[model samples]
Target: MKQVHLAAILCLGFIPYSLTACHAQNKTSQELNKSPEAANSTSETVTTPSSTQIQQAYKVNNIAEFNEPWAITPLKDGRLLVTERKGRLYLFDPETKKKTEIKGTPKVAYGGQGGLGDVALHPDFANTPWIYLSYAEQGQGGYGAVVIRGKLDLKQSTPQLTQIEKIWTQVPKFSSGQGHYGHRIVFGPDGKLWISSGERQQFDPAQDMKSNAGKIIRLNDDGSIPADNPFMNQGEIAQQVWSLGHRNPLGMAFDPKGQLWVIEMGPKGGDELNKIIKAKNYGYPLVSNGDHYDGKPIPDHSTRPEFEAPVLDWTPVISPSDLNFYTGKMFPQWQNKAIATGLSSKAIIIIDTMQQPAKEVQRLDMKARIRGAVQAQDGGIWVIEDGPQARLLKFTAL
Candidate 1:
């Protein structure tokens, strides 16, 4: 393991920002005011000044490498499960530095931001051993995100998924384009399955209750609609919705207090960090701190009081990829905080979610497009880089 030095403090200042859409490939890319129109509302921006000083914060170990690696999670037995964007899965043993490819990952519609996505273990995995996966698939219209689960059979010579079953799917496959398929999935503390389905870059669907796009979905662990879901009476499609009006909500996590939060990519500016509320409308296409790619202006959240506003937003988009709340002993200072991986910003943003309105406190520069970050069993952090030949890095105390 090599000791990595991280800049401890980054002095804040204003910098000009240009808006552009970013994907896995090349695309060029916060604080203080509480006002929705205040583009500088972020307590700090991820764009660090060149004069910032550096210091050692943690020792980083390159655990393994994968092609276009996306999400990662630790298993009960100390092994790690990682997903590759091109429809592949690997079971990695950290202690042995060995990676075993797990078979049976469904073929994905792998192109233009659509591919294998998040991987999560069943909350009751010790007994059930069910593993869940989210990915993009090609259909009649175009492409859409889908979630599936299966029992992980490890006793065989090759670890593979069995009895795979589809749990949820983004209805009405979008023909708009191949962007913003937010297939992020998480199991809430209440044992309900939660999913963030992006609007597929289509404006109107975010506010359309008839479609499941651009909404947060909640369901029973077995893929059945929960009786108490906020929109149970809306329709079969709306029955799965927990909340509506979101853009590309790529990350979601529950804090120590069990409150859920999401980090999503905003337009040219206005990346958002939202505290999700059940059945609330986040006012995406209708209202945003950002504007359309064509430079069309969208009203600020402040203009619409009925719609929910983000607790924190960034002027120069962070292009946040994934999120995890720190609840570990290794980094006491980061305890109960939100760790958001940045793609365009190329850093790990640490936010104080416990505050009245969550604010960014620090950024750990990785100098690479970060796809995801998760807590290790020992209270350290495992970070994955984006795109081809991506490295899986483990971060522990210095």
Candidate 2:
């Protein structure tokens, strides 16, 4: 077991609407985009105000560290399941500051944003103890994202996966650069599994109904498509699509109203926060608030009346990694607020999603690139940092 070191702690009153400039070099070492200079610019800053007056204090505690951790989900018991980018899963105990590696993980295409991604427990986890995972895998053509679920066999000392079965696989794997395999998974309120499939940095596939890439998919727990899906009659591939034309949707969450919202990184500046509607087309590649990496300008969403527009978009780019609505009673002030972890910005930007145009109310300045966050069973938040030797932090109301 490795020793857990406590880092500098932060305890502060909730402040309103302030953000530091993100790092100019937005891409990571293993990021598909080699030219870090071509990422987003760090010049502009936008501050949005909050309507709430109640201020709550919270403290941050450095829990544990992992190698390039991607996503984390809380177990019923006070433990957590975390996924590392390079094909590893961990069962972490926050109290003991100890971690146990889980076995039976699939081989991933590990590089440049392709690897083991999101981890989610089935809604009926207590009775079934099933776990869902999303990762990138290679085939004849290239690598694509896929979803798998297996029962967690905890009877033994070491946790292991049993009855492993792949549920969904992206269509038409491309040999293009290995990036944008957005495989975030969450079970909706209706008990349907929802997944975000990135377009593999391919422009046209976002609009191509023949491919499942660059789309939101809805399916049953057994990997079967829902009969009432919008494109059920369109074709085999289109039948799984719940929404289309997404660029690199990494973060997704359902509000208390059961409405889904997504956060995606833009090419240069325009990071987006969109309210996802069923069967709607969010114009990507064709229309964006930002331009191409090479300075090629794409039309703004306003130009396209047919396509759906984001409720709010960021010009300077937060490079959001994950989204979760704070429902825990610990942070009463943040109830129902959306917490978006940032990569380039290195902050946790909290937004009031219930507003007409979602407004960012608070920005917790974490010096490290934040990856994934989930509410703890005790109404706290567990956040994982990015890259090797990153820290796992926990926040609780003070």
Candidate 3:
């Protein structure tokens, strides 16, 4: 074990925020408040400042390393089930520093943005041992995100998944593009399975409720449509649409207040953090705080009043991936706050959730492309870096 020291304080009103009702007291980045057009209405120009020195506020231990590790689901028995982008699952024991490959996993397409993704245990896992997995499954047209549930047996000599059943798959159609598989599957407080299905870089589909692409789908644990789903009886569109108009959502988690938050990748700039609401349209291709990769300007969110604007928009895109709410005792100051990792930023952003819409307060540079982050059973923050040699890194207060 190593001891690391980070200089942290419970600073209030840290930086100026763009989210409505948030007031930024100081300029944290070069472009903040630089846009004359962005100063009006529900949106404001907020940018992250350069990385600051932490010297090491926490010690880091490489618990386990895997090839392109995607998500970390901490097991109750001091073990972890980690998914690799190559369609494999492993039982990792941090105490033993050993990793054992699970016997079965769905055969993923194993390419750009396709493969194994998020994994989560059923809330009643102690009794049922049901495990849910999201991945890029081969569909008829093209690859689309799919979710499945199975019984996980780790006590046996050979840990494996059995009695597996298909729970849900993206609706309407699949896509030819390999990237933008918005496949974060999480169970909220209501026991409903909420899923994020990306647009696969397809623009118009996000705005079309008839197409399931670029929408969040909610379902019962058994993959059946809930009786009270927002779109339950509105024809084909009633099949599964929970919230519409998203581009490439990668992270989703519930805050202590029971609010579900999502972080998504945008085009050239304008990565977003949004508070999700049932039946709300998020305005993807129609409006964006960012422009197209070709340098073409897309209308900003202020142009549309009906769509739910992002609580925060990253002008210099962060490529955010995983989200974890801090509830551990290790970071008392961060209890119930939102912590997120990003690929392009190579940092973990700490946001203050005490506001109407969450506000970014601090950016801790992790010095790597962080893929997944979760709070461990022991109150430690566990994160996996992105790469063939991706490592499960643990962060604990000194």
Candidate 4:
């Protein structure tokens, strides 16, 4: 794999709130007003350009680099833990600018969107030293995303995983090579593990409670379903489902006030940022702001107000990948803002939540396919790129 120097890429400063710039240049009012079928037909013919030529903010800098870095999390000692799509985890020291490959990760099925995905620290990591990982496990005829928890041993010259246990798995895996395995793992404030499973590109499975393919699943720290779960009493519905009707949700995080938030990719042009509530069904195939890739119409969320609506929706989707709520001292002005990594837009979107009905405050384009972002203990923001030549980048206020 090719490796690029971190300093080669530029780092754009945050756009002040006063700027009213919009990122959806290709989408027009006519397209937005068109019927779903008509809109879908037009979008099918409109090809999207790759990141190499996409326009972005001209001022961002890349601080560090990595190989196909997919997820990034901070350790207690101020070092960063990054995961590669090929199944290797690494320790990146910012001060020393060094990288150490970790050992003992489970073998992964790493090809065509399946691989070792998100890595996160346990909520009580300081006391337990436990870390959670989500990856695509190859078995039988295909692959499925699985979640595992293990202890990280840094005592050795190179850190390694120990006591790795499979906590959850997607049952009845499909053969589709490009299914959206939305495999992000987060620890809710209630000490429950919340995971977003994609619909596996199957429209019908999302509405099927019997299948775990497309649901937000909740489990206890030990991978057991909580007795008080919304569907615990239901005979057939999986006891682990917290909510349903999600398509390729890549980002999930909890705000300071304990509100659980998620962002998922829509079919044609509807990207959504939703605040997840207990037992609430966010309409998916039944209703979407975007249309199908084959130019088919899906109902709009406005038609079904009973289902939870996204707090914010993007018409020409930015392909949001990672989500983080900023509450650090390095940028006090950005406190309580939602920082999202953008793949299609090649930027970091800052949504200011301090105000009622949070809005996209700024879109600071980094000119790279940003995959994951996390706030460091000292308040600096860290981001990872999503490519074979991905890099670990840090952002500081100018």
Model 3, stretches more than 4 Å misplaced?
1-56
Candidates in order have lDDT scores of 0.80, 0.81, 0.75, 0.74
Instruction: List, residue by residue over 56-101, the lDDT tens digit for candidate 1.
Output: 2455666677788878998767789999988999999999988899
Q: Point to the candidate with the largest TM-score.
A: 2
**Could you estimate the TM-score for every candidate?**
0.87, 0.88, 0.85, 0.85
lDDT of 2: 0.81
lDDT of 4 at 260: 86
lDDT of 3 by residue, 1-398 (tens): 11111223222121234112222122111111111111112212233333231122455565566788889999888789899888889888888888888877888877777789999889899888999999987778877888999998778878889989988777645656777788898989999888888987778888877777899888889988888888867766557888989999999999987889899987777788988998899999988887776768888888888889988877656678888798889767567888888776666778776776556767765446678789989888888888677767787775
Best by lDDT: 2
Question: Clashes in model 4: which pairs?
Answer: 10-60, 10-61, 11-59, 11-60, 11-61, 12-59, 12-60
Residue 141 displacement (Å), model 2: 0.4
Query: Of the pair 2 and 4, which is ahead by TM-score?
Result: 2
Q: Candidate 3 versus the native: TM-score? A: 0.85
lDDT of the structure predicted as candidate 4:
0.74
- lDDT over C-alpha atoms for residue 155 of model 2: 59
Q: List the residue pairs that clash in candidate 1.
A: 30-42, 30-44, 30-45, 31-42, 31-43, 31-44, 32-41, 32-42, 32-43
Candidate 1: worst 10 consecutive residues by lDDT?
A: 30-39
RMSD each, Å: 9.2, 8.2, 10.4, 10.1
